[model samples]
Target: MRTYNIHEAKTHLSRLIEQALKGEGFLIAKAGKPLVKVTALGKPEASSTRRLGFMAGRMRVPDDFNRIGADEVRKLFEDDA
Candidate 1:
């Protein structure tokens, strides 16, 4: 691991990112105090925006989904099992 001051980090940001993508991570600091880390993301960022409930109509729910195991679970919690 290597530490770079804020100015140096900004100047060499591109090269540092290349190194990070190659699995060599580093830190950026200000006034000798470490501030942030630079590392490779696990996957490429998605360009297309995603809307909430994208799978809303693609999945199914059972009729008993909300009531699954309600009886025995409640008994165990109340120490009455």
Candidate 2:
């Protein structure tokens, strides 16, 4: 963890950003009061990976999924109205 005054942080923003990229937490101060904290951004997680444990190998795909042509889809829309 590190702290920087407003002027110091403005003057050394690049260094602070480098530190944040390296996973260091930082606090910025304005008029000697803490104003902001900075941390590294997390990498986006995959939806499939997030579905693990509860979703372990339980997906289903019907053969009819590929057989549904555009004409059949249009019929579904016409029947719904």
In angstroms, the error of model 1 at 31 is: 0.6
Candidate 2 lDDT, 1-81, residue by residue in tens: 778998999999999999999999799988878999999888667763574476557877677887769787779889956
- Per-residue CA lDDT of candidate 1, range 1-81, in tens? 899999999999999999999999999999999999999988745644566777888999999999999997888899943
In terms of lDDT, the poorest run of 10 residues in model 1 is 44-53
Q: lDDT per model, in order?
A: 0.92, 0.85
lDDT of 2: 0.85
Look at candidate 2 and give me any clashing residue pairs: none
